[model samples]
Target: MLQNWKKIMLLAIPSLISFATATLTGTVSLIMVGDLGFVVIAVVGVTNIIMYNAFAIFSGIGHTVNYLVAQNYGAGDMKKGIERTYLAFYMCIIFALLIALVGWTMSSELLRWIGGPKSGNLVNVGTEYLEIRFYAMSFGIISFAFHGFLRGIGSTTLSMVIALISNLIMIFLVYALTFGTLGFPNLGLRGTGLAILIGEAIQVAICAYVYFFVLNKRFATRILVRIKWPEFRLLAFESGKLGMQEFSLSLSMFIFTVFVARLGERALAANEIALNVMSFGFMPAFAFGATATILVGQYVGQGKAILGRRAGTDTAILGTIFLILLGTAEFFFAEQIARIYSNDVQVYELAAYLIKISAFLQIFDGLLNFFAGGLRGLGDTTFLLFISLAVSWLLFVPLSYLFIFVLGWGSLGAWLALYTFLAVFGLAVTFRFYRTDWSAVKLREASPH
Candidate 1:
């Protein structure tokens, strides 16, 4: 038990660091742009939510890479793992091109669907921002895909290094370009978007180098030469299903954000601050969940179903404890944290209240985050996806609309709605984790190779 704990920590901490860098990048960017006022902050927040959901397709697809690579690694098929990793890269490129094409053409329509005319100007600004960022989707998606692939095969540290370096570059670029420092144009929100694009492009370059020169060197030259179409299709189908699950979750967030937008600009701005602060605390669970997926998948592959179950449960407990500490800090330091992003007294007050709600719900939040990951690792995505959709849309969104919009409870009500949803969903996922025989659904047939 002690040994397993140690192993999970070792893998998860770095993964957490990588995931945290993304939120940190956004937080710092928001703080810099906070001076632009509430609308700008709100716009960025909305854009972040949209961007995450947009990326969910790739992230969901990447799960296929993780499952396959981890399983292959455990089965002692290093060659098969490498082949799947390469295929994921190719598919990400293809998918990213499609995203760029569609997003560029449909940016206004999408924003209109979510934010309406009152937010139309903000949406326009965000669209321009997304346009610049979309150019790099291919690189970003491929980087993410390879990151999952490598991490699944127990090379999580490599992904961490790439993420850290990419985040540092984004920060520096944002400062340099947004402020017109270092001879770059001061693009503001657009500049921030540009920085994200360039940084992701750099990450893709790094991933390619590692995969082609480093990882490929470790495998045979023949495997490196081949791009197996049948295997690619198999992985893509599985990934597409997972991606749809991810899409549903992200889409739910999009809907919820739109609901907040409807509560007026102040509410929108407050939600942004509250969400960012909450992200800082929830990151550990995401990291731990990533580790659980890898470890659990590997265990299942190695025919050790009992070990996989134990790993999932143990990781969940550790994640809960870690989040509790974070939640406590957020509860006590809510005002201090809110002040970091907003000088408006009203925005600060509202954000603080929301953060308190979020802090109290951290344990529930962790359970939901890690359990979903654990279940995914065990190839239980069928149940996981349906549950996520049901909980987020049917329960969370409905309650949010009722309490915040209908009851006139404002930001407090919105937070309360989220808390309620997390509590219910978390418990259900926990029960499923304890009761389900996850290992029974292992990939019975090999992805065509």
Candidate 2:
């Protein structure tokens, strides 16, 4: 127990720092944007969801990096691990460029496709934000990819320190540029976008210095400047698998947003607020899961199956307990949390209910996250993706629509469906982890071609 506790701390400390810095960025961005009114907040919210889905898909590839590199690092192949890191960085840059183009080209159409008539302001604001934010994509993706590399190498503290420094820069810029406090023009939401770009750029610069000059300098020579055709093909295929898995899981939420829109602008506003609040409260669980992914991957790579299993089990236990306590506090304090975002009676009331449901789901959410990361670390994402698809689409969507539309349960029913689906997913994933073939996976000495 003492050894397990020590290991958990070793892994979790960096994850917690990353989670905290990310949360701070979100909270500060929203609070500043809120000063412009709920409509601006709503616009920012929609933009966030769109960007999250896109960015997460790319960051999903980072997961593969984490799993692969951690295993290699533990197995005494740190140089090979660094080579993979080089591949990940280059791939991220190329993908980020492509995603930015797509976002710029499709910004307005996305709003229209979601079936909203009064979305002119939203489309306009969001498009500008997305375009400016596009420049940040390369930096963001590289930063996230290197983050996985560092975590994989069992350097979570370095990742944590980078996140803290990056977020501090982001927050300072958000204040200086958003409200024109430092003789800068007030760019409003656009300023928020610019701040993000600048912050991520700084992180990438710092990481490059660390990777090339500090940690494993061997990777500098091995960096894939002109992509190796065979290596690129294999890495791309693997990254695509990771990206698609992420898309399948998160697209359900994106689609669910469309459903919320049908409930009117007020409902959409409330849903967005509730989701952001949930992100804030659940940061620790995410941190724990990231820790589990790194630890499990590293141990498994080291040929320590028992240690890997123990890491997963112990971290899952800690994550579950943390969620239970935090959920209770959140459930009892929903109104207080909601008030921090808005004081509007209608928005507050609806958002408060959503928060209440989120609290109930946190336990299930924590479990699913814990096991899912473990499975990913084990290179078992295929099954996890299938499970998520079934639960999110087959179960959650239909049940939510039936409850909200057919049964007239409104937003409350939608919330219930989400919670129930996540719980079911948690159960399914946990069972599969015990009865599956994930334990057999081992890193290939030669890159897959």
Candidate 3:
């Protein structure tokens, strides 16, 4: 167990740092925008939901690439791993174009549907933000692909370094562009979107350079010139299932946000603030989840199902410990954390309450993350898709509507619904993990054409 713990930690530490930094960068951007007012905060929050929803489709491809690359690398087939990476890259490009086109064309209509006509400036501001941000979709896809590949090949440290550098760049740009600092004109919320675009572009360039030159030389594999249609089809099919699951999850969250928006701008902004705080605790779980996926996939490829299961178990245990520590701190410091995101007394106080509520859910959240990730590594995406759709749509969404609309529970009610969903999801996925014969699961074997 100690050895397993150490192995997971080697991957988890860097993955945690990378994910945490990325989350913190977004939090800081929102914090800076918060100073503008609740309206701006609400607008940015809504815009982010739309952006992430689009990106979730690409995440399916990223996960598929991660799983296949890890398996191939573990099986001592670097060439096949490189081929899978190329396939993911092509898929990302095509998907990114589609997302950009749709997002730009329908930004206004989409925001209006969510916020209603009474939303006023929120729809306008959010639309502008989305249109400009849509151009950055390809950059985000490229960065995600490279990061997934790096994680698969056990170069998580490199990925961590890239994330840190990119986030630092984003922070600096957000300060300069949003506040008119360093001889720059104040661009406000639009500037925040621009900063993200620039940061993603920079990360892509760096990742491309490293993957094409440095890592290629080290691995003695040519990633740029490899293509396999059958492998690509297999990856696309797997990724499509994963992508649809992610899309459904994101759509449900967007619907939940819409419910909160109906309560008014104050509620929406407060909810966003609370969610950001919750994300801090979630970072460790997400990191460990990614680590479990990579390690489990690799170990299974090497015909060591026992080690794969042990890796996931150790990661979940470690993630739970981290979440408990973070959640405790969050519970104690909820007010301070909330205040960092908003100046309005009402918003901060409500956000604090929500954060405290979220603290109690962290352990279950860790379990869900690790178990779901482990299952994905074992090519169990179909089951995951079914469960996610069932929980998010059938249970969580309906309950949230009933609570907020019928029961008059407001934002608090919405969060209670979320808590119930996470608890159920965590338990269900964990049970599946424990009972499944993961060794029998198999991805399509890569073959040269």
Best lDDT goes to which candidate? 3
Q: Candidate 1 clash total? A: 0
Candidate 3: C-alpha lDDT: 0.87
Q: What is the lDDT of residue 207 in candidate 3?
A: 92
Rank by lDDT, descending? 3, 1, 2
lDDT of model 3 at position 440: 78
Which sections of candidate 3 miss by over 4 Å?
A: 221-227, 442-449
- lDDT per residue, candidate 1, 1-449, as tens digits? 89989998888888888989988988998998898788888878887787778788777768878877777777677777777777776778788888788768976667666676586667756778767666756567778888888778888888999899989999899888777888889888888888988998899889878876787667652354366677767777778778888887788778888888887777788999999999987798788888888887888778776788889988988888889888999999999999999999999999998899789687787888788777777777777778888988899889989998799887788788888888888888888888986547464244455
TM-score of predicted structure 2: 0.94
Cα lDDT over the full model 2: 0.78
Instruction: Give residue 290's lDDT in candidate 3 (0 to 100).
Output: 94
Tens-digit per-residue lDDT, 1-449, candidate 2? 88887878887867877897888788778877777777777777777777777777887768878888888877888766777777777778788789778866877788666637777766766777867666777678888888888888878998999899999999999888889887888888888889998998999999887887777464443344555666566566667777776776677777777777778767777887888878855677788888888888887787775577778889889887777777788799998888777767788789988999788687888888888888877777678767877787899888888888899888898888878878898888888777765457575344545
lDDT of each: 0.81, 0.78, 0.87
Global lDDT of model 1: 0.81
TM-score of each: 0.95, 0.94, 0.97
Looking at candidate 3, the ten consecutive residues that score lowest on lDDT are 440-449
Q: How do the residues 74-132 of candidate 3 rate in per-residue lDDT, one tens digit apiece?
A: 78888878878888888888887887788678988888888885677787677878777
Cα RMSD (Å) per model?
2.0, 2.2, 1.6
Tell me the spans in candidate 2 whose CA falls farther than 4 Å from its real position.
217-234, 437-441, 444-449
